[model samples]
Target: MQSPPLIIGTRGSPLALYQANLVQRLICEVSGRTEQEVIIKVLQTTGDQIKGELKYFGGKGLFTRELELALLDGRIDVAVHSMKDVPTVGHEDLVIRAILPRADVRDAFISVKYDSIDALPEGALIGSASLRRRAQLSVLRPDLTFCLLRGNVGTRLRKLEDGVCDATMLACAGLRRLEQENRITQAVEVDMMLPAPAQGAIGVEVKRDREDLTEILAPLNDRATEWAITAERAFLRALDGNCRTPIAALATLDGDVLTLRGEILAKDGSLRVAQTVSGQVSKTLDAYDLGFKMGEAVRDEVGGRITFDD
Candidate 1:
């Protein structure tokens, strides 16, 4: 009898490689499989295919499409992805079977003259790859200049030190995962800047029918992150958010309560609508209901103020 070979698909980036190995390591521990049992198969996605320009290629899914294809084609039995980059909506044939322990949920501010987004000089330039961060930055400091920057975490940080733009925004979780927490000048709170749909979460995507794999990964699941991302993704799906839209959300689970905060900004950076909701964590459907309500509320609050469409 021979053991089954597990092919793990992942994006071919430093962080992607790091995360893929972490997933494989954890799975092997839980399933009693040796390192040789799992093989990491790297894929280049649209996100990686683009350099120097992210807005032109696409948004979040740039790194996911290729690995997802590998999964669908059965070339890989599992896929590892940063939950925030994964998207709010799941696929018909695929599902996030587990969420590994989440990392920090803050945005690192890297700069020489400032410790945070606020300390930056008025009209100073800042770079970021997320529409959510750009839109929120607009609402936060209308005076500062926001530019589109695309690259891996290291590349972005290097640009900041090299003075490519002044300062840039990146997820604190990623920084922490790479043992670069000290680089963060500030870890902006969600109240001030709503995080992306699933920031800080690491998810393992497997074929929906793979119950054995699901059970194998179950021990590593972080219930709080899983639940929080579930609520946040539902919100994004309800709002129909995509490349063109500037939307952000974050949810927190404490005991039986789940707290959600969602925001939507106008395309031109003039108006903003934000909402907050809290409910029993078990009522997952309420998360969707609240997300929809928040979007509708923001739409009404802004009152034709936002027109960005994807």
Candidate 2:
């Protein structure tokens, strides 16, 4: 008798579907499973249903909660997610089984007229839903105005064409995955705007008890990307970060040395605290410790001024 197919749960968005299908193809290649033996199951998430800013609702978890619940209930064997969207704190029963190779860890500046953020006219309107982007941009161009802009990649591009806002920002990884790299006016430098934690990586989550699935997915795990994101996410978890807080972190590995950069900004961009730390990290735990220490240092500097929406 044949065994049941492996079900992969994901959100119902163009980019989400693209990530899921990519995983499906990779799984088939690695495990030598026929395409028919692997399935993609699309599920609606709160992040998709809400037409307003995520901070007003529940923050990043809105995108993964439904899929996670499905995983807990045995409705899916695994779930694929954008690592940036996955909350640092997750259900104890679930674990990220694998991380695909990372992509360009940069934010893309998109506009119909302006060539880049610096080219925008004074008092120009910038549309984005990310507190990190808005806060960072506010510091760079205090004359610019910001308004809430929320949607998938296509929706936001259409809004830009419709003249809803002068400019917007998106993840370079998402645009590349969706074949919309041409839409990027400028791939913003990390020095100007550090990316959110775990940006540009794909994470696969599975039940902790699924040793079989873990082994099956092990071939897809990218060790360097795993170590980088492990540190970044640990920084986020240390600060209890969420959509409400403007937090950014990026980790890079050089041989056995790991360097992590982190930032915490006020909502209005009036104040910012940033820090960098480096250490020899032979394992993921070492990376986590390095990040956690950086986060604590930044948090302590910011003091009680850092507040969350909840």
In lDDT terms, which candidate is top? Answer: 2
Q: Candidate 2 lDDT, tens digit per residue, 1-310?
A: 9999999999989999999999999999989998899999999998899988887888899999999999999999999999999998899999999999999999999999989899999999999999999999998998989988998999999999999999999999999999989888999999999999999999999999999997789999999999999999999988889989999999999999999999999887888899999999888899989988888888888898866565
The best candidate by TM-score is 2
Q: Give candidate 2's error at residue 203 in angstroms.
A: 0.3
Model 2 misplaced regions, further than 4 Å: none
Q: For each candidate, how many residue pairs have backbone atoms clashing (under 3 Å)? A: 1, 0
The global C-alpha lDDT for each of the candidates, from Candidate 1 onward, is 0.80, 0.93
TM-scores, one per candidate: 0.93, 0.98
The residue pairs in collision within model 2 are none
What does candidate 1's lDDT look like per residue over 90-126, in tens digits? 6789988888877887777777668788788899998
Native-vs-model 2 lDDT? 0.93
